[model samples]
Target: MKTVKTHITQLLHAMNMGIFEKEHPIALSLLSAISGESIFFLGPPGVAKSLIARRLKLAFDQSTAFEYLMSRFSTPDEIFGPVSISKLKDEDKYERIIEGYLPSATIVFLDEIWKAGPSIQNSLLTVINEKVYRNGQYTIQLPLKGLIAASNELPAQGEGLEALWDRFLIRYFIGNIEQEFAFDQMIASVNDMEAEIPTGLSITEKQYIDWRTQISQIKIHYTVFELIHSIKRQIEKYNIQKEEVPHSTLYISDRRWKKIVSLLRTSAFLNETDTIRFSDCTLLLHCLWNEIEQIPIIEQMVSSALDECISHYLCGERTLEQKLSSIREDMKSEHSLRETKDPALQIVDTFYHQIERYPVAGNLLIFASDYQSLQKDTQKLFYVQRDKYRPVNWILKVYDHVRNRNISQSAIVSLKKGTRSVFINNQEYPLACNAGYDIAYPQEASLLFEFRFQEVIDLYHNRESE
Candidate 1:
């Protein structure tokens, strides 16, 4: 498995030799080819979209490639093959030559694919999805490892092109090189744009066939399955948010998802992993988006969902926020009982917790408007001391109805040893964690959670570094 991965990695590097900013498309195209799935490239001209497909062909040994620029005038004969006039005259049967056209080729590149005529598009649907071509009464199993299609524009709506568009499992957008140095190198160098894959590195027919079976057996981690479901839920939420807009919903069919999982499994198999890693889920950024605008949204959603699912998987089902809330609820119950037993202890008309140990001579209180914020943000605040007769410079900034102005209240607050404590006027007072609230429930769980959380986090970091 390691040797196979090393060979494929070397092959990918060799294929990307002179190409600038096209490594992703080339890699994805090759992966699609080995998985027996088709990819669609959506980009303008001169971005090397066709070159990506051409380079992918070099990855396969003894592979025939068919390249064509489709137009509305294109007929089935030009795409599939010229009809067998001899067969029609001699045997009174209709059949294509099926010699050097798409059916016989191992790799097919069709540019401006949406412009192809209905006859050509109809035949391509079968060829791409089923890898079978019907020439008269015979069904010819295509030698197609991958069909790469490109177009400057998306297919027009209501044109009966939806089926063909859906046939492409992996859709990617290509663009010109952005970095100045790479662009300079691209123009100054006289190296051939075509990649020269090493003969030993190129995949043979026997290897390709064997890989298909191996790829199917690659394990999909439970986390990856949960991540996919999380992404689907995110897409559903996005669609609901954009419900008013026409055709704004992002939809993935069951079949497309199956192909997507297969592509991920194939990626894992090639990378020498027995199970799909979280990194494999990153590929979904390219596979999920339908419109160009949805790319960034889809990327963000996948990234966020992947991180969230990883955290949940490693640190148990409850999140940090939920754990903290549970602690707060328990504390609130205790506070309510304390107030009920002694009404004099209840600080009415004020939201602050009286702190008795401020080293100064004035009464001090810590603002307790929100318990979580008091615990989380108080330590980061700066404090000032003043004379007993003067108001402290630091103000809590609350409206004073009697004076018709805002006023200040002095307080010293800090979070220490998993407890929130405050000092006012030389006396100590504890707030939420006084009764071992933090230590008893959430803190212990959080300590255990953080250890496992960091392990998974480091795993992702190491994978990225590799």
Candidate 2:
């Protein structure tokens, strides 16, 4: 079970890297594929959305995945193949005709799918919906595991393309990276001479059949169904216009929605679970909502929705347990937050002044060397640098919110082992581990809120110790 799970995780990770250099699409497709259905990749060209489908073909049984780049000129013959000349001659339905572009394949990729003509697109609907295709009164069943289609334009004012769009269950967008980040990765990638593939595991036919059987048997809980329905309601309530609405809604169909839920169940089963949880549904919702037009707002909504589900459904008690863990560590480092007659506030103020005197790196070095202490007396230290701090989960809330366009002027409260609790709009919030919270306004240059926890501290400390 662990082996299969690791393989799936690796497959998804590779597919993500090959796609938008991110992991979400890999996750979406895995779920989509698990349900024995198809997915649509809604993004622009050169994002490697098609590459994702190709990689899946390599991951599973070879010679099973087929691909087609649909064009305005594409014809039904181009996909379904010209009626078997002999079959046409004899008018025999039982003749073994050459498989069309998609019917015989297990995994299929339809690139520029929206551009396909109505006849070709209509032919796909049957394969996607019923895993079968009909050609000249001959119906053929497909041994399809999944199909992935790519498009530049989502469902908007198109030439009656909504029906074709409705065939894909999971829809995702591929976006470009910011200039600076792209430049950084480009440089790093060129310099990394020793990069290597992590594993050699490959999928087999038996694995495929087993996975399908497990997914088929997996059950979805009623609560998850309600959650999905509620998400649909949110979309309809928005009643987004064609121009302003998110593309997510434009691409999916009722059939795809049901398939998506099944995919979620299959994912859970593949992960070695018999029953699908609400967490799985939340993941689906996140992917579904991404198809909407307002990308950022929809992203936030999806994250919030998923977070709420995670906190309430999958690991309700674990959230409290995490807080307790932090508190325990806090108690151990209680000595660090000592009361000094010399005035701790003044000391902190002096430290702040000293930080500003040196260059950013020097400031980080000195502040980290002298003052930072953890709740466990664990020798864990924290500091702020000009560029960025090590990754951590401590929530760094800003005190005295800066309405300034410049982020450097904002005041941020850093969380440490013995750090006092912070309030956000009157609500008490605890610092998390190994995560950073940016408190700067969206346009700001520097991060206002930054958090670092034990592991990050150890990384720096170990290097220093060595």
Instruction: Give me the overall lDDT of model 1.
Output: 0.72
Q: 1-466 in candidate 2: lDDT tens per residue?
A: 4566778777666554423344667666656765666777777787667667766665665547778887889887666666676765786553345464566787888888877877777777788888887655667787777788888876555478766666666667766554677546745664323212344645566877788777778876644654555456556655564547444353346766767767787778767778886556655644454344455655555565555445444442453356446645655764634423111112222222122222223322222212233232333222232423433212121222211112353323243332322232233333221224322222212111111233234334332222
lDDT of 1 by residue, 271-385 (tens): 8899898888788987887788898999899998888768756554344445555545655665433322112222322433444444445544433432223333224332333
Q: What is the C-alpha lDDT of each candidate?
A: 0.72, 0.54
The numbered model that scores best in lDDT is 1
Q: Which pairs, if any, clash in model 1?
A: 355-424, 356-424, 356-427, 357-424, 357-426, 357-427, 358-423, 358-424, 358-425, 358-426
TM-score to true structure, per model: 0.68, 0.56
Model 1 worst lDDT run, 10 consecutive residues:
397-406
lDDT of 1 at 113: 97
Candidate 1 wrongly placed segments (more than 4 Å): 191-193, 317-466
